[model samples]
Target: MASLIEDYALLSDLRTGALVSESGSVDWLCFPRFDSDAAFTALLGDSEHGRWLLAPEGAVDDCEPQHPARRSERRRAARAAGEEDPLQGEAEPDPAAEGRPVVVQRTYVDSTFVLRTLWKTPDGQALVTDFMPVGDRRASIVRRVEGLAGSVRMHQEISFRFGDGAVVPWVRRHEDQKSGDTSIVAVAGPDAVVLHGDRLPQGHDHRHIGDFIVSAGEAVDFELCWFPSHRHVPARIDAGASLQETVSYWKNWSKDIPQQESYHAVVKRSLLVLRALTHEATGGIVAAPTTSLPEDFCGERNWDYRFCWLRDAALTLEAMMTHGYEKEALNWRDWLLRAVAGDPDDLQIMYGVGGERRLPERNLDHLPGYEGSLPVRAGNGAVDQYQGDVVGEVLVALEKLRNMGGVEDHFSWPLQKKLLGYVEEHIDDKDHGIWEMRGDQKHFTHSRVMMWAAFDRGVRAVREHQLDGDAARWEELRDRLREEIMEHGYSEKEGTFTQTYDDAEVDASLLVIAQVGFIEYDDPKMLGTVARLERDLMDDAGLLLRYRTSSGKDGLSGAEHPFLACSFWLVEQYARSGRIDDARKLMDQLVGYSNGLGLLAEEYDTVDGRMAGNFPQAFSHLTLIRAADAINGHGQRAI
Candidate 1:
């Protein structure tokens, strides 16, 4: 089995990413692009499903991993506040766990995607640096091993199962004509990768294994290159030079960030993560790298998130544009225009990295899911769903760009007009909300607010910016929407807004009403809604759930941990509402939830104190940046 989700850090070349575990296993990686078929699928199954392990012997294979859980700080805080304990029904700590020594330390080099891990054993210490070369399109992963102390024996094993672990590649060894060094090449169907190392491993049992030792002052290097099988093996490049270029690229891109006194460094890292998830060939950004990590462990909430979501991408751009990254905003604007170029009636919720449209979701029955969660899926079915908030997110994000002096070009303004026309046509329809609920469509309150926001921005473009649009008509609808929402979406008896117009349920998404200018943060109505959310959706773990699963709104079995994004939303609300101490306290806890390398997952399993769902989630990091800005007085909206 793979290590815990939080135990992994990311390495990216602005094309695709590789998930490297703390113990030096590249367990999950996709080739060529973010949405391509994976070459390392062990994150969803066993090692037989393609994985590359490079570490000291006995560090990964034979030893037992002990996870002895105790009460987390969130749980303790909830208990002290007299809230019901959320862990009562959870599983106890493992009985088979035993004490183990810690021998590995991991971190990324500052302002770069390079990962450095140090392995310490009884005999000696070895340092391994892993990264992907950027800007050159080499399509390779370079790993450098350096001996830091006395002699340390190291081991390397790689299994080449292509096509999502279904096809075993034909392996061959050849000597590089230039360097005269041995290299292993594997080909399956149209895909192939060449493994070049100081001492190439020999084949065994459809796998390759190599063993070597490094004494003080000795070093070894490895490079694995991926290319089309018909193409010649890519010529080797200097790994040391590539490292320098990659580092320089990331630092140059991130050097212009404005310093927010308290959370500057963390926000910079969060910004880098968002940038890494972006595809350079196309400006589309993915929600997360690996798919089907399971929102609910040992349950069926797993879904693929490799493709680019319009809402996620738009929100990511907003976070970037707020920090003066107008170039990224324009790039994403072009990508959006290309993706939804056809009739507005045919809009999709998401698209592939290169703007490919058809993403038919399917189950990979051949591979067992992570932690035995069933039906490891590929592609996202949410594309076909009618998500009303998506267009609004795009409009709001573009409005932020406009506020930053990004003038509307001929193409960009026309697209906004088309989007507003779509909103006008679908004004009376009921559709899925921001959560993309699998249940029946209802009058989701958040969706309506976003629709209102779309028109609000449209009206502002004409009235405020002298653009050519029907401001009078859009203003009428925008005003009417506020009245309709306040009338049907709020509860007079409880003085709070409901999740839908039909029911009195509270949703974490309602917290954003203040964010989009629908209401003030400290309005009595929003305050009442917050109280209801704090009473109902705030789990005993002290984090906020998206909404109540008991309402049967999601149409999924079991339950999920609190969403990290929702928790950050609460932090933003608190910060803006003058609860600075409360905001800072909650923000501190939420930031601390990240792994040692300052990366966050989609959700948090509070009972076991581990990260669940996708690793390095774009939602979690983007919301964290927003919340950090709110606390540091850098978050101000046109609303």
Candidate 2:
């Protein structure tokens, strides 16, 4: 059986990532690139379909101590009778540690990206697995294991089924003297995996089995590197040296993150997770590492989020830039320009990592979805939806770049002009909103407000930034948009803004009216909207839902849980409005939603008290950063 959604930790080479469970099973991984076909689909299907698990050879046991703190009881008896639990008396062991099972604690070797996981048996036997790259060479995944203490029996399960469990690889073993290491190579189509290390296990019916005993101080190592099947076998790699270098690289990268006042550790971890989701070479940030993890497990609401959405990328860049991560910000800016290069009319809402546009949605009927959700999807259907807010978000990002003193290249102005033109052409159209609802098109207020932002920023670029553009036309359009929204989107009876022009239902997205500078947070209208949201969208735990489902605006059968981003937006709204106390309280509770290791999923089931939807959502982390920035201010905030 698979672990809970929160049990997995993330590991990445910056180009792609894998989700490793507490018991040492890599259930989700996309090979070659972030948007590539799955090489391990077990997270969305059965383990036999695809997975690589390395752990102690035994059934998992849940051994919760009956008496958690006997010593604390004795100490409390010696002290006052009403004393609190000293452990709880302090902080709650960081909510990130809650529900995390005890395992050989694993992490990247200090400063390097190389991941090391250690496991020990109850009988004093130990196993160590180390994985790192060959120093920015070709696509490679290295694994090394050593036995220490008594004889440790280790289980190694490897499956290379590509295309969401459709293609299987042929396995073979070979010898290589150049690197003084034996190799086990698996070949299928254009993909090949080469394994190298000490005492390579012999193949038995397409499975490798081994057992080794080492003294207390002895060590053993193994490595695996993948390459194109047609390419010649690459030269031998130095696993130890590579591991050390990789650790150093990650430590240095992490050092660039800024320090902040409150929730520093959670913020840093969120930033680390955001960095892990980004493709290092291209700067394209994937929405999540896994696909088809249902919002409501066993339901039909599952959608793919592996591709990069322009809205998410722009907001992620804003969050990174706000926290003093200039290099990543600049890289993302370049990526944005390159991705939307060709023609304004051809601009897509989302794209592949390298900016490839054709992401056709398909179902993987062969493998059952996470928790039995059907028709596991790849690629996103929303790519074809007409989301007017995307261009607005891009314009906001470009303005932010200029505000931060990012040098404008020759292509920047032209790209902005093209995007502005697209927005202008479609500003009057009624299409899907930011939530990408599958219902009928309605005039979403947030989309119009962002359209106004587009025109407003474009006009500012010309008048304030001295850029060449039609300032008068942009100003006229900006005022026209604002007037239209004020007249039709606001509800006089409820004293709040509506989700769409034709409806009176409040949306949590209305909280962004202040953050986008659409209006002051303390403005009477904005405060009323916030209060209305609290009344209509608040879940039982005080988190804001994306919208009121009872209104039946979104055409879906089941209800969705509270969106983490929406709650963070509420936190930002509170902070901006000078309600610092409310903001701090909300921020603390929002940070508590993160699982052990400070990871967040797309949504939270307030009723069930668990994470829902895809794990480690980029939007959630990005919004967490934004909310933190709003609370702590620009420079003083932690990354």
lDDT of each: 0.87, 0.76
Clashing pairs in 1: none
Model 2: ten consecutive residues of lowest lDDT:
61-70
Q: Write the per-residue lDDT of candidate 2 for residues 46-101, one digit (tens) a residue.
A: 66667676665652322222122233233435445666544444432321244322
Candidate 1 accuracy as lDDT: 0.87
Candidate 2 differs from the real structure by a C-alpha RMSD in angstroms, to one decimal, of: 7.2
How displaced is residue 483 in candidate 1, in Å? Answer: 1.1
TM per candidate? 0.94, 0.89
For model 1, residues 282-387, the per-residue Cα lDDT tens digits are 8999999989998887789998889899999998998998888999888898999999998999888899999999999999999988877888988988889998
Model 1: ten consecutive residues of lowest lDDT: 62-71
RMSD of each: 4.2, 7.2
Candidate 2: deviation at residue 372, Å?
Answer: 0.6
